[model samples]
Target: MADDKETAEALIADFQKSIKDAFAVFDHESNNTVDVREIGTIIRSLGCCPSEGELQEMLAEVEEEEPTGYIQLDKFLPMMTRVLLERKYRPQPEDVILRAFEVLDQTKKGYLTQEELTKYLTEEGEPFTQEEMEEMLSAAVDPEKNVILYKDFVTLMTVEDT
Candidate 1:
């Protein structure tokens, strides 16, 4: 619908701004360019997980012939925005998500109470904010037993590629 298109456009604009800001950090010379070698690191730093081959292909798409060791902002923006909007980096695999939850489960109980998930999420690496925790819990938790329904939760975490 029109709303979906508008939302997607807004998302791309947001990604472009964020990509530009991240790209600027590596620009160093204010040249509006980044070294081809550091492209992977830059993309990962922005939280995407493009494979080496994908990155190479993207670079190839952006530059016609032999690359000049640097990728311009205009080239970087569209590619990064596309990948981000496509969620190419996130939506962690179900097995991976299960493994992470298993680690938190600790007792091998195959589940976690709201408290257990709360403690780990708010105290662990790059801890989620209160708002983030609430959002995740609202989606992933089973209120009756107060345990996390991680299997069901996987659906919430993944986006089926359209």
Candidate 2:
């Protein structure tokens, strides 16, 4: 009985350590708010803990499981660490917008339609709605003038929200 208790305590300690490490990665990587769902997904994939259920229930399960048998923490930690690092190093919003414009300008025609912008954003795996694209163009274009010049496009792209 004592042995079981000891194992349970040790396992809990290790899990706590893993959670801390995971949070550190999130902190390092996140420029904006960290999405709770994304963190939960990462935690579940590591198999250090179960993905769903109340926190108390999850802790109880960890306490019940013996420390001697579990996934290798060493292996899982590094993978999660890499993910956090990548997120931390991700490009800024301006860079993303600039790249999007460049992609839309591939034909070098100096203007982009809603369809082109949508296709570019989709290929980049960035989420963009048709309405959003239309709105962006509306703000950038003087519709009485049907073309968006490159300079105007860049200006709109880099404008910081007040």
Candidate 3:
């Protein structure tokens, strides 16, 4: 599995150029520093999907050392690199996510209803806590249809290998 994926250095190297470019945009004074508050915006610009708590954690890391509410390009790069390297932060393959849903669908429906998902996620192995269920449903479920909408979700969760 490791052999099939890009090396850590390679992944960081590929990500750095764009990260640098985006950082530059936020560094208004051209002083290699950007407002710490804007870090989340910069991160999201790169298609990074960090939750609010995660963003706060990342922000804390960048701000703790400086304590000036600003982060240098040098400082920001390493943190963003780690985010890119974290497996949980990376998007899964569309087919893989779709297949996982398919396995649970049981009735051959492409989507799972809220109750069906509530049962699976809450009652199954390593059950999700109520908070987790709410977070997932907010993202993946369709309120009108009361279904998981995995097909549309696959688009949001997967990145094409280029």
The C-alpha RMSD of each candidate to the native structure, in angstroms, is: 10.2, 14.5, 6.9
Predicted candidate 2: what Cα RMSD to the true structure?
A: 14.5
Best by lDDT: 3
Give the Å shift of residue 13 in candidate 2: 36
List, residue by residue over 1-162, the lDDT tens digit for candidate 1: 999999988988888888988898899999898888778777877777665577788888776367688888888888888888777866466788778887777788767888888999889776778997998889888878778977677766765543
Model 3 pairs whose backbones collide: none
Candidate 2, pairs of clashing residues: 29-88
Q: TM-score of model 2 relative to the true fold? A: 0.33
Candidate whose TM-score is highest: 1
Instruction: Give the per-residue lDDT of model 3 (tens digit) for 44-81.
Output: 77877676687788887777554988888887898887
**Looking at candidate 2, what is the lDDT of residue 155?**
65
lDDT, candidates in the order shown = 0.80, 0.51, 0.80
lDDT at position 41, candidate 1 = 76
Worst 10 residues of 1 by lDDT: 153-162
Which parts of model 1 are misplaced by more than 4 Å? 91-162
Off by over 4 Å in 3: 1-8, 91-162
Per-model TM-score, in order, reads 0.54, 0.33, 0.52
